[model samples]
Target: MKTHERMPELLAPAGSREKLVTAIHYGADAVYLGGANWSLRAKAGNFDRAGLRDAVTYAHQHGVKVYVTVNIFAHNRDLNGLESYLLFLRDAGADALIVADPGILLLCKETVPDMPLHLSTQANVTNKASVRFWQAQGVSRINLARELGLEELRTIRQAAPGIGLEVFVHGALCISYSGRCLLSSYMTGRNANQGDCAHPCRYSYSLLEEKRPGQYFPVEEDERGTYIFNSRDLCLLFRLPELAAAGIDSVKIEGRMKSVGYVGAAVRLYRAALDYVKERREAGAAWEEIVLPPAFADEIAKVGTRGQTENFFSSAPSSLAMLYDRMREIQPCTPVGIVRGSNPLLLETRNVLEAGDQLEYLGRRLEPETCTVRAMSAADGVPLQRANPGSLILLTVDPPLADGAEVNALFRKQHDRQAE
Candidate 1:
């Protein structure tokens, strides 16, 4: 099938149960998460056995698919409970298991013979041979390494037309070659492959001359210290046409460790973009002639990032791919609270929200209504000028909204002024 003829899945990351729900509400066709033990994102509130079951149930109920992460590179001791975990995932009704290690693949085949398998990017399936190799091993999908260019992806797709091809369309760019770096383990004794990465690559590095004791030199000519290895976050919203044409089956977002607000905003933006692309494609529009919505240009900025780059997608990456300073977030808005109830609009505050503040309700349908924080007070009905983070607050809504909506405070990053 032609790439535009088939709509690719929008796979979002969900680190926790709440995030999973948020992703689904924001229009994620599928969500990828890790179980507590086998996930690479050890710090990301990964689902326990019960949590995994609940998450799967919730996602499936919403008609969204869930893929469990079992991609950790296992050692001898790690394989002890591997079978049991696979069984748990099978019982949990996960749509697939993201696997990297060859041992894990065999174990999944033996233990949960019916479960689908997706080869993680850690496998670095760059060429058609690797794709075919994984396909022989029963991997239903192969997440192409982040380093692959459009031409490379097209080649792989042409070579292995039957297998599902997934690629990271957005999120943080790894400094390593498909996340095979040893810098984290070598620096902090936290193995990246084992799910305990300390992210030492984002740290600034200084040259230490062996001959000149105690003398440290900056790696880059930046007075504010250079983060030589810290890469800019990937943003390929404009390149969706290229990716869809490259025969990618799924467009994956790369932040399982990100916040709930970020998940919702990012997923919604991508969802809208994909819908637009599909519409244009159906209208017989050429890839170069398709125009994205103007609002989407700045919409992604609401999700905090360390800057943005196209990475290796456009061409060979140079210094343009690296961020020589600290990871800067270009956030123009902040999450105010989450709606617990609609009547009187009870909210669990994530940031200070004042009366008359403009609040955007993030929900499954992407409601266009921007609510004003009229007559705000504590949940107990105590009048308040503003509700701080962690407070259970209430806001008067003109037209009452549905229950379980997420609220975000609107502001501009430059002026720090309230968004009118």
Candidate 2:
């Protein structure tokens, strides 16, 4: 195998402390999170001041970097404690700040001049000129607009080879231009730019003519209303070699509002893909000739999705990118429990777990293992036929967990398969 200096960083989202831990254990090189204020994911389990401090500490102990989002488009009233918050983040040992608004950028430069800054994707940086402009402004890294294609990214990287570039490699896509949309604010009174979006784009809609009161017409023939603006989720697992050859510095997974299972599964799969690409590259394989294992996509399908699309990665997206028939693809598997302890085999149930049922355990560095629920009881040893969501139960398995299954490992059960 040939040698390269570094692999692209696998950046993951951490909506809360548990999610942060899961991302780290699943092999993320860095984690991005939102503080209690100034983050776009106001609905996520953001951290408080004390929590922010502790989160940074914990991530650093695990050799992971933490970038706090202060990327809201601000108003005059929103600037109330802005300076103090900037100082607090700097003092809290945050690695960098992700900012979108120019006012906040200037404030971060003035208030915490020594701290590093990363331009957020919400800034809509689509061209090489925009990349150079931000680079000149003391920005260390820029997450380019998601709408760019692979060739465009290569062009930008060639234009400015000094600065770092990042792109979203997985998760949801927005219909609007670079996630700046007024539909949420106009319809739901929540400003997306200010970080309180209600996701009106995902809502179902039908046409209502002025003359025909109480009459609704479907945009499509389905009984359920049409989803005109719903875009498919992005999955670029197979394109890692191309991205690495393009000199992209980081590949990010985008789900601050998603579940811990989603975070763990995504980070683990992507980590394996990136490593696979690196090894193939080192072995003198051309980027175009590298093919990822098919199981990567099959395993990722276990997590819920609206169907996958390349979205503008290779060329302009077609109408096929929209999910007109349904809101989400039927998930192939459901998370059933989380391993809380291994000594007595304590399991925290996320879904119903019953005796004689088969379960698949998602471990840290190995392929998922299948096991059977031989017996289970309450935490105090009383027998139970089944365990409901949120219950902690002691379990015995037909095939005991392998050597390294630790706390927080996730377990899932496959849904009954149907003929296509």
Candidate 3:
């Protein structure tokens, strides 16, 4: 049994202020988010200057670190306010900056010399030499490329033990190398490098003969047209023990544009898994002997995904990594509402909620409690049979909520069929 010196930090994504709160509530050690500009997720509900400052303070108050993303590949036009933004982030007390472009890295070094820098995986850091080079440039951490296998990761960790090593333990797997794709630019005039990706890789393709201009043929891989470039979502919940043993410093969940439910669920599940591993290790359990409970993976499947894949973790991935049939898996559970107020037990509906529905409230520490909806009413106390999205409804459950069910605790209900 290989013993790690310390437990790896469980990092989660925060696309918005709400998501940030959710991540922290679910026990993330750190969260990575983007600002209004210069972020790879430009379409996300990113923070402005004021919002960034507030987010930093709020996260710090809760004892969680905040890393801001300035990770877009910059063009001449994109460099206008780069220096000012970097300075602003530094002043806002950001724990670190995640950067991908070499020019951005150089500018950060010059502008915010005291600020910690983390090299983004978009930099395609696959080898130990790249890690060493980045470390030489004052990078405190480096998120390794997603294309590397577990053996390659072990070798890289062995070569560069000084710098903090992080990897995407879960989330959508990009078809291109570390998310540097040109397909969006070529197809929709949106450059992925500049962060306005249209996700052309997820678009289905069909065969069209040049000679027969109007003839369209199905490019079928399995009856669902050819989705050649759509890769499955990555899930490493079962592999946490191995990653910790291999000297990985952080495990990241990759979804800044995902919903609050996704953020909370992923963070909660990973937090529990890491804790389980830590407890076992403290009891002198062998790494090979430690096995995570099946509920961890089962809970993760409730969140939306293209499909689950290990990606390039164990070895070179095959065609099985690509979701050739569908864009995303049919989620087994849908996030129905969020606990808005604990006093009256108010819930702000995210999806439709009916009177007779049963919901599973995701409790802190991953101990979910199920309750049957006995009755529903509007905020104004109007009786209702069904509550639509965005409605603030009052719910009466058979088994009442336990004491200390925190506000913003997510609630979900199972679908009619199982998620594939």
- Please list the residue runs of candidate 1 whose C-alpha ends up more than 4 Å from where it truly belongs after superposition: 1-4, 210-216, 220-223, 363-372, 397-420
Q: Per-prediction count of colliding residue pairs?
A: 0, 1, 0
- RMSD vs true structure, all candidates: 3.3, 1.9, 2.0
How high is each candidate's TM-score?
Answer: 0.91, 0.96, 0.96
Q: Residue by residue across 42-118, what tens digits does model 3's lDDT show? A: 89899988999999999999999999999999988889989999989998999999999999999999999999999
lDDT of predicted model 2: 0.89
Candidate 2 off by > 4 Å: 1-4, 416-420
Query: Per-residue lDDT tens digits of candidate 1, residues 1-420?
Result: 245378789999999888887788778999999987888899898988888899999999989999999998889988988898899889889999999999999999999999999999999888999999999999999999988888888999999999999999889888999998789899899999999999887887789999999998987777777787888888888888888877789999988998877777788888988888888888888777877777778666666478788887868788877788765554667777666765556777777777767766665443345666668787777899877788887778545555544533211112144442
Clashing pairs in 2: 2-282
Better of 1 and 2 by lDDT: 2
List lDDT for all candidates, in order.
Answer: 0.82, 0.89, 0.89
- Tell me the tens digit of each residue's lDDT in model 2 across 1-420: 435546799999999998998899888999999987889999899999999999999999999999999999998998889999999999999999999998999999999999999999999999999999999898999999999999999999999999999999899998998899899999989999888889877888898999999999988899867999898899888888889889999999999999888888889889998888878878888878889887776777776478888889999999999887667777787788878998989989988888998988898553688889999999999999899999999999879888745788888887645622
Distance from true position, residue 73, model 2, in Å? 0.6
Tell me how far the alpha carbon of residue 2 in candidate 3 is from the true structure, in angstroms, after superposition.
Answer: 11
Q: In candidate 1, where is summed lDDT lowest over 10 consecutive residues?
A: 407-416
